[model samples]
Target: MKIAASLIATLALAATTIAAPDNKHGNKPNKPIVINKKVLQTSKVPFIPHSGTALFTNWVGLNVDFKYVKPVFDLVNATKAYGNGTLISRGEAHITTIPPTEYDNILHPAGVTIEELNALAAKNNRLQRARFGLECLGRVQVVTKDGVFQQSVQIILKNYKDILSYRNDVFKLFVKKGGNPALFAADNFTPHITIGFKNRDIFIEDGVYKGKNACIHPIVAK
Candidate 1:
């Protein structure tokens, strides 16, 4: 009886060991790796508040495919408090090709409307079926209409040669059509998608609020 009991116990132990979940085989989903790092402000241009109507009346950009950014959205959701910002909707995510600052110089002065620009972009051979890769995360500060500064988190993009080329082509076309080139000349175009914005003023350089408050660090997920 003792021998039989010992064999049965051994069999039960083996069964339990075999049934145990193994993380190495990916039986469980891997948790996102979150890192807190000090990142410099990449752009000198002020962040435009899309919620406001007066400043951002019209802008040109290429819509980003959600599949390539879903993981980023997931990461945003996972680390919302760390970012302390509002999440941008999936449908609204895009890479800004031509900012509103150039509207007066390129679009309006050139007699090219937003609808017309869209049509042109649709027919462009290079832009057709083109996609950009996500490079990294960046943060910037935007001066609001009230002169208050707020922090914004953005996703920097890579593999944007086609987009850059298209932008230059548009600029040249506008300039040729008697549009003012002053604003375009001074404009520093950085192709990125703003993912979220924090309401409170956060110093982007040191990631602190007004240099006295605690720092709300930007979360990087991998």
Candidate 2:
């Protein structure tokens, strides 16, 4: 009877050890990775307070083309059958900084109409295009809970600091035009090019494709 009790205790200890959470990747076992699927819902403009629901596009961002990095797209597309295909256009990768809700609050107070906002975005694009561009480093694979995965290309701005300066300068312009500078979040920005999103964590072959190109267009209300 003593031997039997010892075996039970040993088994319980082993089971508890096995059930302990693993922190190999620094992610907590129960914490979820929330992938932004906002782009998928393009038809309806997401709701914003104190703004008229005029069917206006919710966000404006910098559109970087993949002309120099077409091979990366080819690889992602070839492996897309496993789960997800490319959602972004072959022509441009959207760089979201000023999200719509905040943008509305920034502009509406200043009486900046949609047409005027577009014009400002276009002007900012032109000013930046004359100075710097973006570079593609390679592929970055992200594996989430339940084995869901996503592939994206790492993008680096050639003059990131300079571009940031430009963003600040443009924010000043908007503020002068009646928008709020306090609404901008400069700390939470990251630069990357998303290739595709997957439903399941299926292993897709990862590879590197290298190139650099000038980013000319900044699409607003698009």
Candidate 3:
């Protein structure tokens, strides 16, 4: 009778052990169940151009007189930056009026139509009469993150406040029209013309060049 009772108790214990939840695979140990409430953004974001040929965006600025800067380019070709017998001769030089950044995602938000922007662009065309000047200071070189030296020009522009005001007003309207507000540079905008992307050793003696009325147009993205 004692053997029988012992076997019955052992079977009961085994049954209880098997029936209990397995903590490793099924139930967590006294932990509250967590559910993620945040939704992941799945929509594809827009592209913003930083450097190079403004490929995906539009640009507006004053057309440079290539004839005037030819000598400077000749000097640049002789520098260490372009010493590989490479010469830069045929890129448009212009003071950035409305940078490529201004047009990125300009029509993303609701209610802002391209027609409105085009109308504003028409008003801005009056800026075609705006005259400015640039004084090429000297060579500017910086060690890139890849440990290679990169160089470009250090230039100063006259009547920059007017440009800034125009940029600010356009940015405000863009935001009010539902464009992204974060893309605009409301302050701390430095106006500099990029002479070369890889060569910084080229130097042009300090000189002031006056500009005629430049075109101010709306940049359309590709």
Query: Compared with the true structure, what per-residue lDDT tens digits does model 3 show for residues 97-139?
Result: 5544444444324344434444443463533334444433233
Better of 1 and 2 by lDDT: 1
**Candidate 1 vs. true structure, TM-score:** 0.55
Which pairs clash inside model 2?
A: 147-201, 148-201
Sort every candidate by lDDT, greatest first. 1, 2, 3
Best by lDDT: 1
Error of 2 at 63 (Å): 3.4
- What's the TM-score of each model vs. the native? 0.55, 0.44, 0.48
Candidate 2 deviant stretches above 4 angstroms = 1-58, 76-91, 124-154, 177-180, 186-188, 199-222
Candidates 1 and 3, the one with greater TM-score: 1
Task: Give per-residue lDDT, candidate 1, residue 51.
Answer: 22
lDDT of 1 by residue, 31-133 (tens): 4334322111212112222222365567666664444455555565455343433544444456666666566445666775666555556663344344544
Residue 59, candidate 2: Cα error in Å is 3.3
**Each prediction's whole-model lDDT (CA):** 0.49, 0.41, 0.40
Consecutive 10-residue window with the lowest summed lDDT within model 2: 213-222
The positional error of residue 106 in candidate 2, measured at the CA in angstroms, is: 4.0
Q: Which stretches of candidate 1 lie over 4 Å from their true place?
A: 1-55, 67-71, 84-91, 124-128, 142-149, 200-222
